[model samples]
Target: MARPSYLARRAGGRYFLQIRLGKRAAELFQLPLLRVSLRTSDFAEARRRLVDNLGWVLELIEAPDLEAIGTVFDVRLRAYVDRGSPADERLLAERCAFENEVRRYFTRAQERGYAYQKRFPEIPGRWVDFVDQNKAAESSITRLTARRSYEAGRREAREAFNEGWEPAPNKAPALRPETLDPIAMLDRLVQDAVGRRMAQLAPGNLAPVAAPTIVPAETGNPNEPAKSDGSTATTPDRMSILLQEFLRPAGRKRQHTMKGRGEAEAVVQFAIDFLGDPRIDELTEEKWKLLDDALPDIPNRDNIPREFSQTLFQRFKYAETHGWKDLVRVTTTTIQSRYWGGLYKFLDFVIEQKLYAGPRPKFVCIDPENLAPLPRDAFDDTELLQLLQQPLFTGCKNRLHVWQPGGYFVQSHIYWGFLICILTGMRPGEVGQLKCADIRTDGEFYYFDLRPFDARSGRVALKDLRNLKTNAAGRVIPIHPILIELGLLDRMQDLIDKKEERLFPEWEAYIRKDGTVRWSQPLSKSWQYVKKLLKLSRADLTLYSTRHLMADWLDNEAIAQRTRDRILGHANDVRGRYGRKGILDPEIAAKIEALEPAVIKQMRKMLLSAKNRADAGGLTVLKTY
Candidate 1:
């Protein structure tokens, strides 16, 4: 879609609504052009804002006098109109003050024209020419608009005086400098009118002025219960406060891990920063609309949640001041999935608690084109050949120097990790964090046990209780015959005999700064190095290609989808829910033994021989591939 000509983009990508004023309007405005910051780089957001404010802009351009322009941006115009009783003292005082200001402007205009006439008696078309020729000329809009106001006020003042509502002769307001600038004068009048409205609508008198249709987010500290004695309590209605209540583990509706809770908190903070700490009661559909509009403008800069030292509002200001050339804004999908999705749950929690009575915000609906999941391809025969030919698979110097070619036929985690994933379709992390006890048997066949660990995975102390990705991830898979033939059982027996807990003791539990533990990072890093060496690295192929390869083999073998899903630890149908222990099935075991990929078959002979030689205390030294 072509960008609108009225919306001009800056070098840094922020949009500005630039409208050229007409000659009469320009005379009123004292400038030929008007520009406003849309406060966004996103084209869609700018377009949405244009649709909302464009009419007001056009109306300002066509406005004959100051009255219309003064209230152009008055979002609370209705509130101002409804403020105070008809005979209110504040209203009468405001009218008296307004009349005095108008008479003062009229006198100032007459004095300026008379002064110009006295100075240039012989030469002039009119006092306007004198004023226009001066370096700092008064806008004709202000003079004409002020004169119109004075004429109107004179009639109103005469009626008020006859009705005995006269201003005190001793209490005239102090003199102020003349405001001849059109926009400045409009701002001043709007401010005075709003002040009177606010005073009349202050707490103890009436409810505060209504907000723009904009929704407000929860922020600040949680609200405390009022005293039982029934004294008034200051309500802690900020979004930050409410978000804490929702995230509190004991009272929370849904339990999340530390990382998950952190992510949710970040989302709430984002809403708070963007929409501000409006009380829960202050939220409206329009505030939510504002949030929706601003979501796309959020830059997709790296290290968010970690490096976000400033609020979203501050970031927008920074971008507007500086430039967004180095940043890439988030997509609508990101907005819908992460930003809006997280907030949806929060709003739901608020409603559930009865803290807010507003309608819930709907999720951001978006088209599904270009939103396909990333493709992970199975490793082909040639790629497998290249991988098996690497020194880590064939022969390496030592465990630490796996890249260097030597006589060391060490069958460690590095050697067995990829093979296990390919044969059993177990996740790399599950394989990496395997315990010797996790490899179990039911008299006839052995299988791998996969479940969350309480405190330890092997001898390593976990940062927290290690968790599976989903409930279905906790399952058992029948061990392939290739693994048994390749001495996986012997490796487990060896670890048990040595009093080792973990199957792969070399892989230490890695704790991140956020206190999350990772088991597969070391093996994944090694895979990358090996892939780089063999020139087999690509977006579609990784350690996960092994799982995809196994899935493909199972599909070719005519395995039922449910059986395949069960074997691969995917969420299952009715039967999966009944099995509490997840022991190996005989039919599943037979199916697992029935299938064999050509890539594994080609490398099987060499791998088995290497394992046998390593078991017999011998070495297969290799100087070259």
Candidate 2:
């Protein structure tokens, strides 16, 4: 058999391996190249040892983060020192003896000054070389301390030599304060190795502890529930970790988009803050009740006093004592639906994943009477009049500040998103996520082919895989005549010409820290700013009001219920039955054209007026951020 390219024979007829590190691995190990002695002259034995060494190198390179890299190093160190044997004390003794010999060179009177310091400028390098020559594995931390110990040992040895002291070879030397403590370094590594071994054997030996335990004082809330004996019964699995597990494809049946995952995490994080991240097994009925009671205390999403409180628990406490009548609190509907609903899903996930071995914990019962979903307050005609005349729709000073008035008639996602929502009754999320490909022409009329880009469906490209809230959310809706007249079709053609993917390319996707991606964040933020400018004080009045307005218009027009449901993406329709082809496009377009003609005319009149004013002031189109 031939020797591998990485293998080489030393003068002593022993084989050694030399492997160059990748950039990440080099940075992590603080080494440019690694050389390991196979310690065998036979080519076959050297090849066998190469596999294990290469595997370790690969593990170091593949580690995700610093902590993970540290874990790999720790495992390597443990493997060297303990070897998974019952003779850990003996192993430590061997390490102690080796460290003692290493100290002798620095402690000798002849080797204490510039001559020795110049020879080994970096003690860690010398230590690494020493370990490599001896074919012993050592950790990076131990190597680092070696240099520190060398300098300390040299200082003390010089002082002791001045006092006419001579070192004895038979015994371990006593460490003075100025000396580097090699024993302490060895003790730490030994403890870590032994502790990990004990932990590996601990789980099977542990008996189940009692319930109704006192919550730890550091948790701040004394009433918070814990396990029996004032100690936790379960392992330390953080709520964030389990929540991420559930949000991923493997833990739950459904896989959510990045935005959906973020929303789920936010809700679960609230529970964690309230419950002190209690283990799944420790979540009792009383703990559940505490969360339920705190639900009412949670400030409304829009009304949270972020300046005063940080955590959900702190905000809840602040809401309890503050009796300002104007202080908006979360309603019964919000508590029953969002808060309780989120926790229920998480609890179900835990049980399904077998994270909790005991019977499922009972949640507080929400009264059927109070469980009704609240409809968002729709914008009235007056509110619409004020909102439509804003700088974004009419004209703005520049794209950077859409709220400021000027001659620049900027038309970006923020301008078109509101129009799309109001005219077509599409959700803000749906409108914001539209691609240029979603636009289609039927005969003489243009319409939105509103359907999710499912990779399985093969109807749309995988690259166009945007999220839909529900199966019913897949449907076609005709573009309103006002939008066609206002250059929407022209804009679509322009985007196609430019080969831009999204209809609104300026609106970038927002990614949360946990890696959930969301569109419409900027649109939503701009909408809030517009609302503030328009003096719309009601918290419930939002962009969704456009959908409500469209629904009311359709109802007042006496459009068919089925048609209205299809247009609004109501859950009445079967999942995949609608929006395949433009079968109902003509009928829907004709009906939309006929319904609210007066309102459409008024909107056209407002647009024309705004245009004339902007044109008189030298109208120019500018790009948005």
Candidate 3:
């Protein structure tokens, strides 16, 4: 019934322990009032907790140095930095494990009714706060138990008096005296533990430790400190480190494509080589402009102006003399989109991590005049015929062999894979990553199941999984009669017999450093060989041109725009969105089959020629299509 002391109930119906700080401590710690929640609804319990809370406040005030009160949070942060040190790998790993344990322990304590944020209002909630709150709660509970017993005893005595009987002497329970300040006791425990850890982690140095130096890019010069505003700045986060962190699974929900990652790495490497591998904070607008200026000189494989081409050829010759090989050229769009986009993304991460103090830079835009014209994507019928007649597509001992023809039919998968792409509007990757199981039969129709699967059976890595470019890419495409006649089902059966999960097991998966598997690498290489042998002059007639060719074919056949888009894994329109996505309708399948007769006749001619050669060599003849 008495007015609460410094412990008062707020509008939330919970009690708070309010204490006004002195001028010196307030300025040092940057707070005026230390208003911590007692974390109780009962007034009596609040009063009891207030005693312990006030003790901690007094201890803080009396301390010689505010920084001396190092918490487990500081220790954990220090340990994280140490773990990145090349010199103390073993010790740092141990410290990291210990830090994790401490974090988990405090998390459990929080779950067990310990109020962290409420108790330490000024300081960020950490393991040390959890420990203190837990200890204080235990002490309060003990006092509560004693207080309840004493009250019960007083009630019994009142009952005895009402019954007109004299109460027994010394029978009443006595409330225990407050022997120790709970907060002070916990503070001692936390400080002692933290002090021991700090000494172990960094012997003799009681001062706060700085964060560890981030691992720089491959081309990064570690000795060079980041320059900021014409002055040497503190070692900023490395660009490579920033990019790696940006690509981490937790950083973003969507995974980056291999091409995207390659572009990012290329830009980062260029930036480091050109700009001396400075910290992310050092990636100023001026530095970016330098990169932009250099982009034009970086020779691109794509078409360029005659002057630029001559300059590139001369540079190539000069580089050949110096033994430097495979120099990549960046286009204006590559600079504006891939390079600038990568830098922009990295900058975003820097800003998000609060490492960059500079204002956000605008995205690099290419001038309409500076942008190079893109080449045609679709291959002409003559080019497509040339592609079909290649040695790899006909029959070969090894698909990789430039000219050897007299061997077992080892290139059937590669041959059919390309043929399938030309007939159906499928991506190269989609065909390359197809498993035996993906060649499914539904009733009278057979189709390729271009859908993702759980590839976590240790047989294949995540990167090896059939990753689609987009949601619409996961579709069922009915097998064209040309593919079926080319023994596509028989090929799947052969793979199944060999216990191979992938239909194109011969086309080995190339797992990238980042754990992304690229099944299309071998296929891409073969296509390059095919293009070179056939003397294809059009840069746009790359392996992806198969899909473009199909687009052209379907368009020529006067197929619906939605149907064409659906077949080629393009985004669907409003009407197309109404039905089940990625599932081919029976009517649509019939229409897809309509374009197969011409393709079948062409494949039949090529197979017949290969069969005749095999028969002449006394080799087993391939089945007639």
Using lDDT as the measure, which candidate wins? 2
Writing each residue's lDDT as its tens digit, candidate 1 over 161-190 gives: 999896867977898867668888899999
Q: Tens-digit lDDT track for model 2 on 314-386?
A: 6766767775355555557676666677676777677776787666555565533332455697778878877
Q: Candidate 3: TM-score?
A: 0.53
Ranking by TM-score: 2, 3, 1
For all candidates, the clash counts are 14, 1, 3
Error of 3 at 576 (Å): 3.7
Candidate 1: which stretches are off by over 4 Å? Answer: 1-237, 241-259, 277-281, 297-337, 348-355, 365-372, 451-466, 510-518, 528-537, 575-584, 612-625
Best by TM-score: 2
Worst 10 residues of 1 by lDDT: 454-463
Point out the worst 10-residue segment of candidate 2 by lDDT: 84-93
- Give residue 62's error in model 2 in angstroms: 53
lDDT digits (tens) for residues 101-162 of candidate 3 = 34443443344644433444333333334334334545665677799999999999899889
Q: How high is the lDDT of residue 326 in model 3?
A: 46
C-alpha TM-scores of all predictions: 0.52, 0.56, 0.53
